[model samples]
Target: MSKANAHVVWHPTTVTKADRQRQNGHKSCILWFTGLSGAGKSTLANAVDQQLHERGLKSYVLDGDNIRHGLNRGLGFSTADRKENIRRIAEVAKLFVDAGVIVLTAFISPFREDRELARGLVEPDEFVEIYVKCPLEECERRDPKGLYRKARSGEIAEFTGITSPYEEPLSPELIVESGTQSVEESVQIVLRYLEERGIIPARR
Candidate 1:
């Protein structure tokens, strides 16, 4: 190991994750929403967050565009940058899990390998991969940000589903049909899964 790295040591938190979970009355995990641009990942994630907030559950969403404006501002849309972006977000999500908060992350996360690495950062049950399934044509049709148009005009470089690639999840824990389902429907599906898995309590 490098001398600089050898000097760094791990420090445990005073309050444990279980302690926080017990006090919060819900288990902590990351709801990883992955899909192509304009596939409704951000919409679903925020909608679910609102539901959890209304239920007084400890939950938060780390959105792609919002996060890029802050934590990942300097990162660009390149293969290596995308990989690093996912890595940094995964580490942040791990910290959230340790704090016993149900965190939701909505990102394109185009590479399966990078998503797998993110999943590996937490426990088996802690990583809930939700694939927002929508066809390329549908995504282009619903291009809310005009990203598809820009990408097609060569104004954007290495954009997923355009110049770049998006590797779909082989077996996600849940698949939300974003093209056909309304935002409310998609939110319920995610919330139902959390309740079924005992991560969050069922509606009383």
Candidate 2:
């Protein structure tokens, strides 16, 4: 990660992204899922990932907790750490896109500036910002991870949507109400969007 090295060279691959896309029979893009915890971001992301896999499309899901287990392990929950976490995630997601895989990222990613930083890394159309719309009270009600409970108890600090804030997307490309709809319905909505946008071929 040190850019200070003078001998580093950018190596261009012979097989370009376009070639990879043609071989895979679909274009690659980033499906960025952002919401409060317990809002079904991970669930809906994996659901869509499963649907894509069933259709023989190359896709991957980068969940926040999972990523933190390795790639982002040392990072903490502070504001500076959160920004670094998102920056690294965006870079990695960009690599996945370049490799011709539709990468679904499920992260709270509460800051609009951070989200926009990710969006700016890719072609405008290749970045799909999915705002998983669910009220804070509803998310707290679900509390699948018990994070909200801990936050309320002062056991955890800087927790998004509780002690900290979640900046909702001002103009997300897609909005899915995971609070009300079934996961199946949400998956269908995403698939349809990809097809409609010509990111993937129509259903056969």
Candidate 3:
């Protein structure tokens, strides 16, 4: 059992999430982009974030390597560490949502249970799980980070698609075929989804 931190007390904010959302002029959500290393998850996420920013919407992206270099430093690629890594990211994303900003996360996030844990932290409609689907061969061929080479050569262990596993989402909110669709098309598809779902104002 875990010991409770009695020194830590709950502090309620006068300005609630609803108030922040009202001020931002739109609802907040988490656009979770999960896929293989070179599956264009980061590319698609950044593209979508750019459009949202251009539309004057509050948005931010939590990238994998960036987070590891900072907030998630010292976390390894073991099963438990990976779970902890995801847990920490999810908590941060939840906080961003509370602050009325759409948080787009681009991570391998190969496990469905970890994604579900994040999803459970928010409202049903607030978590948009976007599966950036691409075949393993294509991802390896287009390995932007050279991660595939490292993983294939045994330089990196517990890699998602090579050494480890990648369990696809059973029913994700959106599935962008990175292997088939262009980045611009994927961005438009996500924007259209936000509009159709009334998360943001429709384009005039």
The global C-alpha lDDT for each of the candidates, from Candidate 1 onward, is 0.92, 0.92, 0.92
Q: Compared with the true structure, what per-residue lDDT tens digits does model 3 show for residues 78-119? A: 789999999999999999999999999999999999999999
Q: Candidate 2: how large is its RMSD?
A: 4.2
Q: Write the per-residue lDDT of candidate 1 for residues 19-98, one digit (tens) a residue.
A: 99999999999999999999999889999999999999999899865688888889986778888899999999999999
Give all TM-scores, in the order shown: 0.92, 0.93, 0.92
Candidate 1 local Cα displacement, residue 5, angstroms: 23
Candidate 3, clashing residue pairs?
none
lDDT of 2 by residue, 72-156 (tens): 9999977899999999999999999999999999999999999999999999989999999999999999999899999999999
Clashes of each: 0, 0, 0
**Could you tell me which 10 consecutive residues in candidate 1 have the lowest summed lDDT?**
3-12
